[model samples]
Target: MGTKTPTEADILRPIKNTSTTYLALVAIAGLAFVLFLIGWSYQLAEGMIVTGLSDWGSGGGVTWGVYIGAFIWWVGIAHGGIILSAAVRLLGMDRYMPVARLAEMLTIAGLSAAGFYIVVHLGRPDRMVTSVVGHYHITVHASPLVWDVTVITAYFVLTATYLGLTLRYDVTRLRDQLPDRFEPIYKGLTIGYTEREDAIVQRMVWWLALAIIIMAPLLLHGGVIPWLFAVLPTYPTWYGGVQGPQFLTIALTSAISGVILLSFAFRRGYDWDHIITDDVFRGLLLWLGFFCLLFLWLQLQQNVTGLFKPPVDVGHAAEGRLGHPVYLTAMSLVFLVLSYIFAQAIRPALFTKKRAAVAALMVLTATLLEKILFVVEGFFHPTFDIYGATPGTYFPSWIEIASITGTVGMVSLFFLTVAKVVPVVELHAIEHLQGDDHE
Candidate 1:
């Protein structure tokens, strides 16, 4: 890391003109806060009904409705960052070393947004303190919501800690240029700057990275997803054996694609076309293709097994999509097939053109649509809510939407603010080691 720290200007150079993206996102966050205010005001002035949540029958109702969805969505997005950065660190993937810093930062930003969104969802967002520290007299069952909060908080703290330590390693590179007075702060940052050797640094990196990977499945598929099973019956697309693992895979996939996209954009923006070459992204596209294929396979198996096996009756209508699984219907099938074709085959072909990029983009977009189908058709829709919703009829209001938007925006805000403060790229980590550090 010595003398190799990429400056703030270096990182920001690429996204400079694109401030508009962050701006719009920030505005949305502001609007969400206002919506939270309005929703709370309405609740206070007109009572709980104004904001939607009462005894809520026996179910968790609108309060946790979109909150659940939003939490999972953002968390899913954030998980990708962690796996790519921290997980890759442990896996000892040297190619990924460059973007580890950026990925870790992005993971923190996304998780922050998710946390804020959960905070806003609390109808009693104000009572979050009690929610965490407060006691529940009733015997508390293991709620997925509790797990989501707990994991997000722990991941956030852990990732932030690692990011801080790594960033210090980064700043150490610039030690010579800095004044003598700043040495102590730098020394403090590196925890006495003693863990600088490759042996010690690599060991520490291994621990953090391993902890994240082993716990990731629990935090997500275990924490956020089981609630769906508890709520939706065992037959739907969202609740079957595959959905949880599928979510984790897609998160990893999206994180991969997103990281690749950012790298390309960052390179183009910073004019680092030499260092950030197409080779970097070409490898990613191939890996992404593999992920796309696996996800498509998973989706096919879930839909086919559910569709062909049996159907449940929800009154007169076709209750579960098990009858046909219309959500992933024909369009989904076609896209999934094409995505796999392009991703698994064409994208990795030894041909050169814009084709790989185009194909990768297609696969990523289609995968996102796939995710929407997974969470929405079954989880968001009330018809699939015997175990989850009540008698069933869910229509989330403006507050939920705005609040969610704000939560996401706040995440973007976190990234923006943090980027402003810290070096986005890990210069030291990016150093091409001539010796064993190369690993």
Candidate 2:
């Protein structure tokens, strides 16, 4: 009767196959264990060197392959959460509350996934502190990744605090009536009566807008789009006028797209179609379409200039870190544009649920490919005698896999655990969503 809000029935209640959120949370805990085991095994059996990354002949050592891929993957995921929270809070949409918790939860999970193992991925794995603060000083102009890490850490703390506050609020609502075992927990969280309606509204707005402003550049910083250009044998692309911003665009596109996909998925899980409806998704798709066209134009402009450069003289372009013919021909340009059209355009206004899901999946797949090609494929530059040779292939060690699994699992668990106690969707918020759906 009360819109899936965690009622006494959640504990006193029995339902089919348990809550999806509960199962997901257990899965998360399992992943966390796997991650710990992986790290432990790596430390015991092979030692640090087995990580496959080393300060070899390359100028610096950083783990590529799965580590980098997962980092980007999780960052994209976190971006979705942050963007969603911003949307709801900034717009004052009540309907978004259900999935808003998930957004925040996923942000905590995905970011944690990336941050935890990056150190393991480091070549000089032990001196991580020295690298961040000492050797690799944070400079706004020099390297955005440094700032990226800093911003991400700060962002994570805020997300955690916000989510915790929300759960605590729910706990206080039920503490007296809750089982005696759980009563103290809620009491501990109250921290002297607070969380007035005005306070919640003001805080949410401030956090939503402020975070959006911070996140745009933060996404770019973590994206390392310019550095990927450095992977070009020539330094030109890295130094190019457009590459940095392009990377930022990619991050923004990927982030918002993720938000749409996740929103739809969660809605489907609960049969919220009456509330969420296709219209919300349609609006999101149109926005994605706009970004696609913008990105396509950028690619068209940059490539056209490259093609027109004189053949013999353009040899210097290689030295300037411009993309080689091989890299350029790779699928990013084609796939990036196509993914947008297929995912955002026809599918939204026309397709059935099944068809839309497939399209969403395609968007995710193509998006990952684009980021990977931009990161790994672009970063693959041979040195000295290895000149003109293709880049080496690398795989993620088990530790990395476990770490990622742990990240995903932990987040899933957090959602489930929270769902058992807190309200996952806003009953009041559902009215906001009704505008788009047919009753």
Compared with the true structure, what per-residue lDDT tens digits does model 2 show for residues 1-439?
2234332333222112367665764765876867766675665466656655442234333345556766776666676566666667777754455456656666777777667656656644565677676756445456556756766777787777666665555556646555565556567766675657536745765675576656555443334534444334443333355665555555545555555655665555555555445655555555555655565666666656655653432333343224544345433544554565575465555545454454445555555555544454334442332334434444556665565566656555555555444445543244334433333
Q: What TM-score, over all chains together, does every model reach? A: 0.73, 0.71
The weakest ten consecutive residues by lDDT in model 1 span 313-322
lDDT of 1 by residue, 408-430 (tens): 45655565555544456766544
Residue 216 CA error for candidate 1 (Å)? 1.8
Clashes of each: 5, 17
Candidate 2 yields a Cα-based lDDT of 0.54
Q: Model 2: what TM-score?
A: 0.71
Off by over 4 Å in 2: 1-40, 43-51, 55-63, 91-98, 123-125, 130-145, 161-189, 195-197, 200-204, 218-241, 310-349, 382-410, 426-439
Candidate 1 residue 243 Cα shift, in angstroms, is 2.8
